[model samples]
Target chain A: MIVSLTHLDTPAALIDVPRMQRNIQRMQQRMDNLGVRLRPHIKTSKCLPTVRAQIDAGAQGVTVSTLKEAEHCFAAGIRDIFYAVAMAPGKLPQALALLREGCQLSILTDSLAGAQAIVDFGQQHDTNFDVWVEIDCDGHRSGLKEDDKALVQIARLLTRGGSSLCGVMTHAGSSYELDNQPALQALAEQERRVCVSAAQRIREAGLVCPQVSIGSTPTALSAQNLDGVTEVRAGVYVFFDLVMHNVGVCRRDELALSVLTTIIGHQPDKGWIITDAGWMAMSRDRGTQRQHRDYGYGQVCTEHGDWLEDLRFGAANQEHGIITLQNPASLDIVVRFPVGSRLRILPNHACATGAQFPHYHACEATGEVHIWSRLHGW
Target chain B: MIVSLTHLDTPAALIDVPRMQRNIQRMQQRMDNLGVRLRPHIKTSKCLPTVRAQIDAGAQGVTVSTLKEAEHCFAAGIRDIFYAVAMAPGKLPQALALLREGCQLSILTDSLAGAQAIVDFGQQHDTNFDVWVEIDCDGHRSGLKEDDKALVQIARLLTRGGSSLCGVMTHAGSSYELDNQPALQALAEQERRVCVSAAQRIREAGLVCPQVSIGSTPTALSAQNLDGVTEVRAGVYVFFDLVMHNVGVCRRDELALSVLTTIIGHQPDKGWIITDAGWMAMSRDRGTQRQHRDYGYGQVCTEHGDWLEDLRFGAANQEHGIITLQNPASLDIVVRFPVGSRLRILPNHACATGAQFPHYHACEATGEVHIWSRLHGW
Candidate 1:
């Protein structure tokens, strides 16, 4: 039984700080070479230190999924904030509060009613709000199609209703389902084209369309060229997970976020080593289930972070993780892992996993651990 | 748009207080009639107020999965807390800290090493620890099988190693898979039998085994008689979810936990009404996927808590939920839901979904909303 790091409670979220730094640098350098500014989405790591690291590495601004992220980031001195999800009308007062507090907040809309709500809110507040028209590149989730007439219509409403029609943005979120480089590159190009097309149409309609933003972690890394895209936004690259690894974007070793857990017991007859981390610690994200490799809940590794390739982390309860042999030939599971042994579990989705904890234990390569607080809810 | 609750943020965790009270009442009443102590597992809510409600309604003590939960509940004057997850040896100091602080903390161990560690720790501290031997009722997760020789061995280890062998406990978590009443009842009886048999074996070995505990929400609710069980422990009954609903344990209307979200945008042609509660808010728990009914992400309900049976919440990104018609197409999706309208999303697993937020907006049937903080992480 290893006594070192026993102080750390099992089922703790750990951030490999050096690996995270490498990931940030790699993404920033790629975006720099592509001639587009990187606005690292703060959704992946809601912790400010990671966002600050990205900002210091030349990330232009930050893209947030919730108002809580904007509030947390803004309070931490990040001025340029983009609320990436389409604006909800009821949230206008909150947005106005942020704007009044001098947050350069940009909101999104893809529908005529959505745009109208923003416009009406802006008029009601007697202030102009920065707005982006979301474009649909791959029909993944939200946004208007690239050729949708509502793009220009929404732009016109924003401009006429006293809100600034800042630009067009699209997230090729469907790129996550792709595993090949060619498919990723094609989707990246389409993502770029969609946003640029929407922006061009808006500008052609005599509205101010200054910025064109497009990305998803896969598209951002795979795009061969960024013809008209002004800024690239991507989350999850900072702490690439098993899902991203399966998508052929990041190497499995580059995964920075992992749940530090301890082997609590074992079902020796069943070749199962039970750990304290389960769906509660690793999260319920089955992001890699349909990929080339399906990491049931997460991938297991040794205390020093070496891959445990033969052991499969599978079938989790709330707090009990059942790790068993992939080949299942009856090794002494109890004697091998024993109790009190610690292991690092690479999550399927970093964002979901990180949210499971209130803070991350950032461990440096030199073995120093720092606790970084994370913003949780909206 | 209803402006009454517009002050509340979107994608918020909401607890319908009245419904929650009913759930607590239903479980407590059942346990009361079953002639066993109801040690409510606080893992579902992880909030003090809800646990206090359960206690106020006749629960004996609380069952916690993490030491953090134990610490929090203990601080709240909940003296008897069973740290139900098998004791991670490394967490012994933390658990010891709780025990030293006058908290009646009961820890569990299913393996020899686990029992040895607890015994060693107690011996080193010159104190006797309260220990529960976990029995594997069903072949789902952790614990030793009822017939396993380790049952008596571990019990003897604990009793001799300066620790009080409190009893044997088991959770028929596999009961979550059953959809019919007969299967649930069978699993419940099996769960009780396993715990009782293990305790009987330990007692036959002349060990001090005083209690027999067994449960899972489905089994706890379905058990015809508790025969030899001294106590029943179950969580997720406080806020029943779609998963429990699929298991035929709880009704759809009995679920107390729901995410309060706003319609943010739409893809009218695709018949998708987008909302702010995506996986980030509703959680990544697709617990209902393999069940009788698959609520894609969650079941959509009105702000007043009425179910929208036609709308299925499908395909979620980080911050956007796509709620669409079950029959596919034909609805004026945007007009029906609108951009500012509020809706409640019933989760697949209440425990998973409730953990997504730091606090729940506990809305009384009288329309008053109170924030109840939840304990997150280790």
Candidate 2:
């Protein structure tokens, strides 16, 4: 049943279908121009409909952060999938199940021990697995260095154990911290150079390495050239948020995801409008706190998606969001956002905020709303 | 079917059942001594099994932050429920449905506009509703000030419209900021005093107001006297977190909730152990940041629940948590927490962390694990 926005419940995740489509097109077009396959990260949405939209908009495959997402996407008929996180040994069984069920799933590993575990499991099961060597480009979080001898060591271990070395993938997650274009571009280049170099090192070592994947939203959008990179993976760009806005990747108007809430009360003395969308709805991701612009919890927007510049969601409780006006006592707080009036709050991190809900209320420009179920937990 | 903790999936919410029951018993005993009913807030653990334990431990009723929680608890055979947050007009129908179903749900409102809406809706449907007035005791988030003239007006509106003026409830949520006993005791008294004053004012206006509830984990544990208060509500105390640890409410050992994660990889140079539990598992609630001690993401613990003080979750990405050694370069990071090993991380906020997962792996001292489902979304 298609419902209108007004009829849907408050504190709901609303995806502006047009805006999401536009975001998908923008990223897909950029990847095409860069001569690389776009592996849209489904972790940002974790919804099959959203992934289908990305694939429908020219994405080559889906990237996942968890095995559950891999299972969800693979069951939904997505042939190509990459379980992006460094594979845990205990999770090998789940991955093996997915592969055995006809999923062209690729697992990642940054260390020799991890690769050895994968190879051992594969050899024991008599099934050669497709594995990707993760490279650390910006000293970000996980992955091995481009010059780390372990890269080729891991690749050799996989090949020696009858497993196929699919490629090397690196995420310049630190790109989220860069607001300037030069830094983003430099990091993007660094990400590409490192992964491509890792792939080269493996091939030079008499090992077959077929792909070089690199990206993060900022790096993907700012990369001048891909060169040897085969595919690019990026999440959060599909639903740009306050953090991405502060990072200078997308305009606030381009934010596709928002939490639809209703003003339940007002602390007029403090210029605070208490809404139903708290940290639980907006998420506790104070991602924009250290960014160029700090949106307390989120930026307050009108129900029609217009920005409310002076009003900000400064504090949040479990189910109560305290929206403070820039100029306290300047406006009639109660008169402006009276009780029962609905409002939209653009979250700090789209990925974090989207994960809070079980499903998304895809709101169309024509006032139609459709529920899209999201995959929860690992 | 009972499972073992070691066999469950990584990044799972693990509730130490014995510790939880102990926490419940402590709170229930304290409320009993204070000569008041304890209405344990179900928002912390939105699971029937958890709530059942609370009810079994002498909790008279349950307090809820969302209508969904109210419905869930009511369906689970809970009759007395206080929908604590100020009633959103859009949610009145849901509340009415619960009331019609004999849930004995009490709704709260702080504004005259909200009270009038409730009265209007009640009259329109010819159904008298039990309403509670929310009093602002500490200028924390929501509710009308105890001295505000609107308090009596709202109470009058409820009574005149044939709705039962149940009582006044106030949460000294700001008490979370207090770490010392003196301050916590004072705030507890202040919360009780103001709420009692509001109840008295309502009665002076010739209205029947019986209940007076006030609490925060810190304040509830430190309260010297209940005075005129009839019942109290506190949620996070059930599954004490790092925030409660800093609040001086519960010891680290008493923390019942934790995220069971597996070591996936390591960055030896940086002395970082990459774990599968990231902010997505621990949540982004930096609630202890401004407190006495700031646990970066959480305090790392052994699978047996022993605190690893030398290690800390210094950083987190989407699905990767970087655990850094307190004395970096001292011990061998890889040797200490090798790839595929398991660890438990106590979260900053139990409510926020528990909300991240679909179910909790209730771990027993004897190595038994029971899956307790969680209610998600509004």
Candidate 3:
């Protein structure tokens, strides 16, 4: 049964549940056939219910970017956790605490100093922690060169310090820069070669190098080969946003999350329709910068997730959004949407926009409604 | 005593607490002399401790953009709240609950339909609510023009519906568009005249306009005239950001919050330094779009908050940031910032960036530290 529409306070965030579920199932089924473990990145949905759904979808573990996410997931019975960002000495204490709480925690490090700091923390705590030396495959974010001597030196130092080395992990972050499938495939090969070579070098040094993690939603999904990779950490796959569509990672229909907003006012003379949603509600994520299309701020939607033709959020302030109608003279549809009419907005980056709101108002494809609470903060 | 610098997280959010205290005090003292109530907006900090500090600085009430923010402030002992966005019928039931819980909650609405919806919701819930008709002083966001018939109709409907008419409020969001102090002052007068005219029109229609609220940090701070404004609601004043400095609202010395990040790598050949902090860490707040000077992503700083010369964040990705040195050839001052060196980054828009992280590492202007947790979502 359809729930009666409640007047959502202006600037409230809305999530289409059925779309999210479909997106989740699509990824899970793909990974199931791939024969590698799927560790969905929790940073995408900070919501507990979404994570629970991922676990139910056969995800082997969850990857997070912050300690608070690790703590929240662990408290919610998620045991296998990988803190994907490089670890620091300040966070080691918290990581040790989580490990002692019977949680399997693995951290990434790209620098010798970072490795030394982790070793010092491990020594002081009298604990042997799992360490993953991050390798820079595409020169995207942070990672060591695949052939850098410092990688071996840091790994050897960790091993000498009684820390268990968990092999190497790298993210082909630059894959998002590719404009087509061929470039995507090239990035995938780069990812595989760097990760596989890093693993080989560590093993050649006579050490156990079993786990080699490599991921990026675009690279992971488009990769032609995953010969030596043991696990993939892909987030944003479950709720592909406008950025994904622009980068050739997914299509508009594949995007799951959207901001449900209401038309609050209209400037008929200017052909501007204002919504209750603004940067404060929709987040300031301009994910279209690297894409072929600029969906000015975000793509506007009709009630059922269809892109509203020619409508764009041309500009926004904290609580104000101005939509410019592509053709102000269009006679088929009303240019001035009356007050209280609801509209859905597709975000530029689902992760950043999703992080703004507290709960997800999940709705099935058939429009069945449920509430999902999201965890926030560190 | 200086705290020992160890391996803290690479990209962590830090706030200068002493400067924050001074910021609160200065705004509070200004409002006190103006003989108007200070309903400081919490959208900037979103932190309970920061809100408490505002209260301690003699703020009369709090203003928020979302119900989640109102709920957070209410739970923290803030009784008087103004939900400063246009309210909808679906969200009214929840607002009524706050009223039932003994909190003095007020909401803004700009249309007759919006007012009717709230009235219907109030009837359905059997609760009374305070309503304010939002007025448009300068075509910035959603609001009824002072001379528009819609304003009169909305006020009549709200007064006739058993809901308490708390008068009108307007935000001069365009004040941020001004490039000089004179333009800011002109915008302030325009805001004052528009709001006062709206209040007069309401009173002329045989209605009591009890509170006329008008605010924008620039207008509020530079306004030589606030003849009819009963209260001022400006949030970003407490933590002046780069946007404030760009608009001539405040100087850089007045900015109290910044992102604490670490230099993680260096591309000596490209004259680019990489930091763990990126768009995800500092948020995508490009507040200088309309300003005379575009400060790239944000202003760079040393650990003690001193502005660094010529170093600016040239490009950023979701998890990576590239800083370009002003002079590509200068290598005199130790060309490489050690991998573990910590740096502070000034924000573009304080409200948007502050919402990205969970808590603030509250540090004193003198460099002492504490932690303040932030609340999110409704």
Candidate 4:
């Protein structure tokens, strides 16, 4: 019980501090070499200490997914916060309050209507806002096409309506699907090109688009250069998971986040070792299922962080995980993983898995554990 | 400014209180007709008001998934709480604390080693626990086989060790895979028979196996008769989801839980309307993917609670949901779902999606809303 994770409750989120620092250093150094500020997305951890570590590692201000997150980061003294998702008109008051409080906040939008609402609300509140237009480099989830005519229209709307145009940003989230370096690097370049091109189009309309931001954990690490980009905003790199591991960006050993679980029961005949960590702990993010290597629910590891390649986390209930052998030959699973034995599971998505916990058990290299509270709920 | 769901923040969990009460009434009446106690599993809502509604509707005890949930329910004056997962030795101390504090907490185990540990811990603490043996009915997740030889061994171990063997319980979690009424009814009967058989096996060994508990949302709702069962425990039935709907247990209109989101941006070319609610709000539970009808992520509905059958929630990032048309045709999505317009997304799995929020905006029949806080994390 001397500060080790062994005594903590099962299905607890464990953050290997050394691995986390190393991952952060690696991402920050890469961005530095590429001459771009790393505005680390705090949406991944939602933990102030982790975000502080990123800041200490030469990363710039944080990027948030929700205005609630923006408020939390700002309260933590992080002034340069960027709300990366398109601003919904209903949340304008929340953003206005954050900006009025002296937080250097930037909101995003990809549509003319969204931009108009933001500009209109800012004017109504008599507070000018720094707004970034979202661009879609990859045909993924959100954002407008890089070459869309709406790019200049939105930029003109923001700048003309007394809001500061803070350039363009895009996340090639599709990079998570690629496992090859060449393809990832190409996507990263495409992300950079698309974002810079959007900024170029905005600037051509006589509006000054100052910064061009682009990233995703895979793209940021695989990018050859940031010739036109000014800053990179990447989450998940702070706590790489099996999804990133499958994407060929980080090693399994570098996955800083894992769910510490205990063997509770077993179905020996079925070659199964039932664990207390479930999809609720690892999240329902079967991110690697479509990747090169599908880590069923998660990659199973020993209590000391050693991977158990022979076993796979195949199924999970709300609070029970099913760990079975890949080959299913007799290995005396009951004896090998008896009741009360501890194991760690590398998650499919760090953000999704981390959200399942209220706080993380930060395990230092010295085996000393500390509880770092997380900001949950919007 | 009215107390309506439309005024709440986007990506909020909404519970139709009237529908919830109706669902509760329906389940309670079904259990009454079947001659069994209704030990409502509180794992789905984890909300005090919701649980109180269940108790108000004649639910005898509450079933929880974690000790944290037990603590919450106990603090809220719920005494008969059952932690249904196979007990881990590591959690014995936490369970002991709850028991010592006068929580009528019933713990579970299916393994001999687990039973031994629980008995030993109870003895060491100078306290006796009411323990229930878990029986595997449908080979779903966790539990011992109904006829496993270990059943007698575990029962004898607990009874002789001074711990009270309360009963045997089983959950036909695999019933979720069946979409037809006949298969679900068959599985329900099997679930009841297996659990009753396990108790009989223990009783034949001259032990008093006083209770037989069995359920799952689908099984409990579809069970023709629970002849030998003392009580039935079902969680998701309180807020039926699309998974339950596809499982032929509940209808889409009966789904009491939903995520209220606001349209933020659009990819009109791709027939996408990006909403603020994503996997973070809805959870990544694709429970209906392999069911009879695959709801991509969720079924999109109008803010007024009318289902938009043409639209499907296809993909999601952390906070971005991509709502696309099932048949990719131009419906002028941007105009139809204009920015700032509200939308409701019916989740695939109620338990998984409900866990994503801190509280629910419970809307009553009068369009009035109240905040019902939830229990989060262990």
Best by lDDT: 2
Ranking by lDDT: 2, 4, 1, 3
Order of candidates by DockQ, top first?
2, 1, 4, 3
User: In candidate 1 chain A, where is summed lDDT lowest over 10 consecutive residues?
Assistant: A1-10
True contacts kept of 1: 0.97
- Cα deviation in Å at residue A201, candidate 3? 4.1
> Comparing to the true complex, what docking class would candidate 2 get?
high
Q: Candidate 4, DockQ to 2 decimals?
A: 0.84
- Between candidates 3 and 4, the one scoring higher on lDDT is 4
TM-scores, all models, native as reference? 0.97, 0.99, 0.90, 0.98
Full ranking by TM-score:
2, 4, 1, 3
lDDT of 1 by residue, A1-378 (tens): 112344877788989899999999999999999999999998999999999999999998899988889999899899999999888888888899999999999998888988888887787779899999888888888888877877788888888888887788989989989999999999998888878888888878777899999989999999999999899899999999988998899996688998999888877767888888888888888888899899888989998788889989877888889898865565666667879888988899999999989889888877778888898878
Report the backbone clash tally of model 1: 0
Compose the digit string of candidate 4's lDDT tens values, residues A251-312. 87789999999999998888888999988888889988887788999989999889899998
Clashes by residue pair, model 4: none
Could you give the CAPRI-style class of model 1?
high
Residue range A1-378, candidate 3, lDDT tens digits: 234335444455566666677777877777667777888998888888888888898889999977788999999899889998777556678999999999999887877777888888888889989889888898656677878888788889989988899889988988767769988998888898989999899889887888889888989888887888898888998898888887887877788888888776676656777777888777887778657888887999886678987898888877668888877776422334766777888898888888777777776666566767786655
The lowest-lDDT stretch of 10 consecutive residues in candidate 4 chain A is A1-10
lDDT of 3: 0.81
Instruction: lDDT for model 4, please.
Output: 0.90
